[model samples]
Target: MSDGPTHGAKSFRLPISGRLLVISVPYFWLLLFLLLPMLIVLEISFSEARIGIPPYQPILQFVENRYLEIKLNFGNYNYLFTDDIYVSAYFNSVKVAFFSTILCLLIGYPMAYGIARSEPGQRTVLLMMVIMPFWTSFLIRIYAWIGILKENGIFNNLLLAVGLIHQPIAILNTPAAVYIGMVYGYLPFMILPLYTNLEKLDGSLLEAAADLGARPWKTFLEVTLPLSMPGVLAGSLLVFIPACGEYVIPSLLGGPNTYMIGTQIAGEFFLNHDWPVASAVAIALLVILLLPIVWYQRLEARNRGGAG
Candidate 1:
């Protein structure tokens, strides 16, 4: 018999070149869409604000005698610290995002747990309900809330019909409205991750805990919560990251007094026509957000190391 005797064999292996190409696709995409745009923004941040079509002075130019000249404005970064508005906006954005993350966790955990523990047929229907809002336009959904939360809107009308309150409460165009919108919009993000993690949990662990005389709540605290931490962190990040830089929700539902980094950045870029300052603020926001991501990675690494 020949060393290679099989005549009906089908090879599914990719060549080295093919593997490299597959890997490089995502790298190429990141370079094009993410890195390149960031590099442009970074370059703009180093430039000075100027009255022009582009609205900023170039950092790099060919000067007299064909010499390359570079002018970097460190004031852009300093301006963010010096300005009270920017400083306050940063703090407020972080505060809102933190609270929103907490609220989402509180609300989503139970919903996710229920979904995870549901019958297989029912799980699909429940999951569909959780994600159903996504089928509609996000803008439309936010706009719909405007009708519901307005002073004389559906909520107040119902309350008045039941004589629950003497007057209509001012909920629209307020921080309360912003929080409600944030929670409503980002709840799915929290739920999906928690459900994914919880669904994979071993039933035997719970059974063992029960056999060892642990109560339901005690078993959940000792066994379930610890195991579901990855999902918690993942969901928190998913909600917190966008909530920090949230422009639409704040702009629509939040009042003029609502100070957030998104609104501040928008003002600098559009109203003030200060591109460099806006870019600097954006870079600072990116740095702030990057810290949590780095921390999460290190935590995951530590968990893996301990497990190993």
Candidate 2:
């Protein structure tokens, strides 16, 4: 008998042409939207610029005046490393991002855990409360902080009204204000991922550990913490990467003494009209951001491999 015409298998099988079309559409869209823009940025990053001219200066003499003269220069990158200000900005960006990410994780993890462990209906309500802040415009929310943190703002005014202080304290345009803004802005990013992972945890495992003579803390340390690590990694990366490149909050809340790489790059591009240097700074920021991501991916893969 010929092994042919499996009726059940044929019914379950999708058309080959349809499957190919489904795969091709997403690949085409990715290339068009994501890959193409990245390539353009990379191309511009390598191109040289003169002092008086923009990075992509048109060359009238080339290709019957249709083609632009594209010169490659690494001077901008060289300048980034050799300059003290840029180097300091790089370190400062990393330091602030790292600390802010840590703070967010510390604050968010407990909140997420509490929400995740609550009764199902209560958990839903609690999660909604956490997420409701995002419905407002992020920029507007950050701006609202300015009124609260300014020297003569509501915080100081209330304190003075209560006779807690003799004078209004300077809070806005300081590193502390920047930290507060960053933590507030990115806390949700940390909490959501952690809550998602923690919600999936099996209560039976903890019970089993207790039955096997494990203490509550021991069970959490050995099982719960390890299982929730993926969420921790995801949340940390989400917070750290963006915080490193944060521009608007830092600009609004921080003084000149608190300049970050993002502001420096913006200054180079807009204020100085130095596209090459701006691109260089952007590329440097990208590199710095990628290091943590790459490390996280490696660690994640290793953990998965060990688990498997």
Q: lDDT: which candidate is best?
A: 1
**Model 2, stretches more than 4 Å misplaced?**
1-26, 51-54, 57-71, 210-215, 295-308
Tens digit of lDDT per residue, candidate 2, span 41-118?
Answer: 666666666666454542223666877655666777889899999999999999999999999999999999999999
Q: What ranges in model 1 sit over 4 Å off?
A: 1-29, 295-308
Query: What's each prediction's clash count?
Result: 0, 0
lDDT values for all models = 0.91, 0.87
Poorest stretch of ten by lDDT in candidate 1: 1-10
- Cα displacement (Å) at residue 44, model 2: 2.5
Task: Provide the global lDDT of candidate 2 against the true structure.
Answer: 0.87
TM-score, structure 2 vs. true: 0.82
| Tens digits of lDDT, candidate 1, 179-294 | 99999999999999899889989999999999999999999999999999999998998899889999989999999999899988998988999999999999999999998878
In candidate 2, how many Å is residue 273 off? 0.9
Clash pairs for candidate 1: none
Per-prediction TM-score, please? 0.88, 0.82
